[model samples]
Target chain A: MLELKEGVRHPVDFILNGKPARGLAEPRMLLSDFLRQELGCAEIHVGCEHGVCGACTVLIDGIPARSCLTLAVQTAGRTVETVRSLAAEDGALSDLQEAFRRHHALQCGYCTPGILMSAEQFLRERADPSEQEVREMLSGHICRCTGYVGIVEAILETARSRAGAR
Target chain B: MKPKPFTYLRPADINEALQALARIGEDARILAGGQSLLPMMNFRLAQARALIDISRLAPLAYIRKTAGEIEIGAATTQAQLLAWPQLGDATPLLSAALPHVGHFQTRSRGTVCGSIAHSDPASELPLCLATLEGKVVLRSSKGERVLPAAEFQTGMLATARRPDEVVVAVRFPERKQGAGYAFMEMAQRHGDFAICAVAAVVSGKTTRLGVGGVADKPTVREWSGLPNGELDDALNDFAWELGGTDDHHATAAYRRELVRRLGRRAIEEAAKCSS
Candidate 1:
């Protein structure tokens, strides 16, 4: 049997929210734990350590991923984005964030960050996304409050608004 | 729950990974996407004394097609395969079923072979593999061998692979020309495991029907000749014969009923698409 040795810590250096960050994590440390406990970024919540709950979703190299399932060291040299990155440099809310607020898409707010992250990426990848597409994208995320009516509306409105801007 | 402490080794290539597996033996588990293993570990359902991190094996990340088949490397992510422009044309069944495996997020990190290797009875990829008659390539220090997807997966979370061997790639031989495809699943929620899922590839004279979540492993039953009355009754009766057990998510009887309903719907859906 392979032995578990002591004193193993891998160095992880990466770009987070457009800022450089570094940390040392055991091989088993989850990225969600690294973000919340080590970096003190609490916005990314962990509802189920399993992949079923999308609460721990984040952007790895700009792709939406469940941070709870990813190892901390796996983010090495990659760009990581969280709900915190959705705001503008001047502190203005991004279009999607503003849309969420306008539509009251969130209640309890635990699932909001992950939803916002997933929605933002969904919009970024596809231009002029249909309402059905938006709903399909949100299927990965669960919202206890609002029953996803406002959340889906907000994303659809954001897509329309973004299309007008373009 | 945190996984029991285990040493981690990131091998740069497949040879190194095989060597590490041989050295570590049963104590080590291959860390691919970790979409399944991490959850199992966190829930204390799976424990490993060590992990061979093969995510860095760049050579194993590829999607190539020959004249008659599509080959996907072990390190290929589910999302990557989904996004490939040619995938829908080459393997319509896979393209149709990939989105149902999990959410887009989990799919982003989940590897092709990893999903195939996990062999979850309710998993979409395995059902597609079985329906399409795919092949799984496994390699270890003892050398490499190829097994049909039907032979590769033995049972729920069980496979024919020896502990030392790792599934290296999956090959989907080309489907019959002008085959129609449909994938349908009845999950509690979107992205949830299907209570019962079905995939069908229908040509003018032959139809391959695959069912999941009604048994310990996905089952593929093929029929020759166009859809007939006997097919529906036979399928419903056949579904009852699957090794289903009552669990919290569903009852064995409920699963059988789902198999009957979803199976008919899937066949209809496939029949509609046959060009």
Candidate 2:
């Protein structure tokens, strides 16, 4: 919705999904908009647009953040990971994503991408997280569908599986 | 869903940022995290001709404990502070209150001084600062001034900061050992703006209580071990003195009750902290 205007733009170069991606982004353009429109990363869903919804969340420099609230230029020299980065090289699901599928963690799926990114980061930080701990980490994410029951189960299962593998 | 067009300037240094801010004056807004500012801009609630981006100004991203206070640089992200174990020991109230600020995503980019400067009545950071008698450092091309948190936040979404001055950092007066503290809030959801919240520090028999969302600015007061039993009478006399009015989140009458109940609970919990 912002490209129609002639305004100041900045050339952004960053690592997106293990690949170099460069684009000219306006100052007023949000990272969510840049990822969706310019980089063609459509997994970032923008709900409520006000940052309340976790639909547009992404990993900036390996930390989950609301891309809708981050400007495109802010990622000028950083690494960004979208939900698309969760798949294996052969397109098989990551352990976390498989758990999500096995547990039926999503319903409408609009909030799935953001939740997956958030859970992935949480799991990375905490190799063995309790069910309560998982809930607390996920409290920041809002999952309207599934009542957060299946999502919680999925992350817990993944954490258990990872610990068991060790 | 889009912000109005504006020019963006990423100053390489703090002095350069200060100079540009002084030159642009009210026309420019400092971009720190953009959690609140961007959302406001998207809703057309705020507009600026220019935005001075300071999120990456390395000099302003620091947390230092000096003398008896913790100095937090303006660009210090909430996530960074939350990860600091030393801060957890020094300012337990801050660590306890941080998780309630926003979800993990917002906290990842939200800045401490940004939250202080935002000065939302229901925000947990402001409530913690007010309860701790913290100070905010305001800097400009001319000079710098330090203001106590109580004096810095003038009203809802308003502060004592001049247009040319940027909130360089915030200073939290370090608490002594055995000062038990707790933060409690009633939000509609986990990450939503709190309808009413309270921060309390219980040191022996005395207590310091700060209530948010019930006033234009958070209300802080040092009290004796007993509760403020005169709340009903006090409301009649100082309704305007409090921070909140009748808003959509909660009615004034209901908020007053929360202040009474939550304030008591916070003090009780703080007393249980053991240190």
Candidate 3:
């Protein structure tokens, strides 16, 4: 068993929710585990443990990555954001989150965090991507419950609402 | 589900990375983008005592045009390469094949060098590299050496890279003025590992075809010129040469058919460019 000590001298620094975090973790500690266990962000779930399931998705430097397959230490000096941080300061859902809720994008809700993070990144990069683009971008994520229709509708609605707002 | 514990070293530079690999010896693995290695680790397909994360070596993460070659640092991400305008000119086969590698998310984290190093028979990068006759730069504490793409790949998930060496970069010769390139692959699902992929580069009147996923390593076939009905014959010959065993994704015979169909299409496309 590898012992965990306070600040045991591993250089791992990354910005989380506009705050800088530094820690020392075992080389094998996954970013998902580090975020959940060390950083106490339990919303980042571990679905497949492999990269196939995107339940552990997070934005690394504004691009979505599978946290389960990413080492915690490798995120040093980078920006790591989870869906938990996407909400407003008053605990209100963002426009996309509201759209997901209105569209009923979640049934079991197990895959919601990952899906939300992925959708957030996708919308950020491409505001008005087509349905096919959305489908292609979300292929890396697996959602057994929602069947993806509601999710797709939610993303499209968000895009429309955002376009109208602009 | 968590990976087995291992020592981690994030080298500041390529020299330091090579030194760490030498010190850790066989127990160490170079971490480029963690797209493949990390997943393999979680699946317990690979176990290492030390991981030398090379992502921080920015000098090894670029796409540049040099004298007569297009150079890409080993750490250059697939997404970055796809966005490179010169890639369409220098190696359009790679640009055409990049979108099929995986989803947008995977491409963001997957590096070209890592893909080449992993050398999965079904991967797109290896086929493109081999077809383009790309060169890989490898560095060790002892010295540096360059290996042609043909010599770099040895087998499925294997390469000529020594345990003590780190791949620094790859270079592709500039395409000739009259060269045309085409790439095609079939997968059950988009972004999935290819069932069979073919890349071809035609210059003047000659053509070089490279096929992947049908053999242990990428196979390249060369033709003097576009002979009448020769494209079909070459496809058949390539299929016969592959002779791979059936697996879950596709049967050997089905893959052979794909090779024939896709090969003919790629050649026709290349011919259009020449004309």
TM-score of chain A by itself in each prediction = 0.94, 0.93, 0.91
Stretches of model 3 off by over 4 angstroms after superposition: A1-13, A22-24
Candidate 3 RMSD computed on C-alpha atoms after optimal superposition onto the true structure:
2.8
User: Which CAPRI level is candidate 2?
Assistant: acceptable
Candidate 3: TM-score, chain B only: 0.97
lDDT of each residue in A115-166, candidate 2, tens digit only: 9999999988999888877877777677777888899999989988898998
lDDT of 2 by residue, B1-275 (tens): 88888888888888988998999899899989888998999998999988888998898999999999999998899989999879778898998888888877888899999888988888999988888999999999999999998789999899999999999999998876888989999998776899888898988767777888887788887756554565444433433456356777788877777776777788779989855
lDDT of 1 by residue, A88-126 (tens): 888899989999999999879999999989988999999
True contacts kept of each: 0.62, 0.56, 0.49
Q: What are the lDDT figures for the candidates, one per model?
A: 0.87, 0.85, 0.85
True contacts kept of 1: 0.62
List candidate 2 stretches off by more than 4 Å. A1-6, B225-243
The model with the greater DockQ, 2 or 3, is: 2
> Which residue pairs does candidate 2 place in steric collision?
B214-B244, B215-B243, B215-B244, B216-B243, B216-B244
**Model 2 accuracy (lDDT, Cα):** 0.85
| Candidate scoring better on TM-score of 1 and 3 | 1
Candidate 1's C-alpha lDDT?
A: 0.87
Q: In model 1, which residue pairs have backbone atoms overlapping below 3 Å?
A: none
